[model samples]
Target: MKKIVSKKDIAHLDQRFRANFINSIEGFKALNLVGTIHSNGGTNLAPFNSIFHIGANPPLIGMVSRPDTVDRHTLENIRSTGQFTLNHVNETIYRKAHQSAARYDTNVSEFKAVGLNEQFINGFSAPFVQESKLKMGLELREIKTVELNGTYIIIGEIIHIEMATNKISEDGFVDIQQLGTITVAGLDAYYKTSLLERLPYAKPLM
Candidate 1:
């Protein structure tokens, strides 16, 4: 049986309860480690669950940055450098990836603090999580503010991709389940994935 929690109830709930409850209501979210480098050459790695593909034509991906009310190092660096990386969190590094969220001083590199390796290929400004099995290099396309909530939507165009060759299927679909990409619930819970049957494109009977 489902418990009914109305808007009124939600509004009256404890603050921390509301945070966890609201975030968890969405079921599962895609978790990735966003890597960036500050203008002073300080590197950062933070995990986020808000990444979504904006389009494939230009290979764009979008992610959300919470209100700038607090010090958001990732957002600041992306703006200054116009580059960042979206690296999928896998089973091996999920704990380290989660730990990267702890508020650290500006001079600290979460990549180093959390024991994850930082990788950079020529021409890409942002670092990549070398521990990640699947990673994408992105160039900033736009940053739009949400007038209602004060959050931000960052859109980026995928410029480069690196992954293990065997993870890709012959038809070109990247096998995420095989890659051990983890899905997150609420703030800290992580779950591994398994492949279900793939169905053909839906078509209506005439």
Candidate 2:
């Protein structure tokens, strides 16, 4: 039997329960560890499931950051340095990536705390996860605030991408599943994905 949850039902649900329900209801999401560096050279890493594609021509990407009710080191660092990195969470490093979300002191680098190695490349201002199979360095373009929720929509332009050459197909498609990239449902549940099939672009019947 199908169950119905109205707006009023959601409003009255327990806070944590409502959060889980709404987050998971949207289905699987891309999981990436955002990496930034503090002015004092301390590194910060935080796992975000909200990274999304904004455009392709200029290679834009978007990510959402929670409200600043408390200290959000990742957001703060990005604002200060105008640069950050998105590191794909793969089977070998998902556990350490998840641990990056834990609240830690501003001076403590999540990479060190979680036993992940920090990697800098080609003079990029931010660090990348050495264990990640795919990594992207981005420069902040703009930050839009949602009035209703006080969350931030961070838009960035892709500046650099590092991955295995074999992961890209001749047609320009990336085989993320083959790279062992993982996904997430809701706040804490992680999942691995497998490609069922690939379909060609749709067109009208002749």
Best prediction by TM-score: 2
Model 1 residue 32 lDDT score: 95
Model 2 root-mean-square deviation: 1.4
lDDT of 1 by residue, 66-99 (tens): 8552228899999999999999999999999989
lDDT per residue for candidate 2 within 1-206, as digits (tens), equals 99999999999999889999999999899999999999889999999999899899899999899865222798899999999999999989988988888888878899999999999988788999989988999999999998888899999999899885565677999988878899999988989987889999999999
Candidate 2 wrong stretches, greater than 4 Å: 69-71
lDDT at residue 14 of model 2 (Cα atoms) = 99
Taking all chains together, the TM-score of candidate 1 against the true structure is 0.95
What TM value does model 2 have? 0.96
User: lDDT (CA) for every model shown?
Assistant: 0.89, 0.90
- Measured against the true structure, the TM-scores of the candidates, in listed sequence, are 0.95, 0.96
Distance (Å) between predicted and true CA of 189, model 1? 0.9
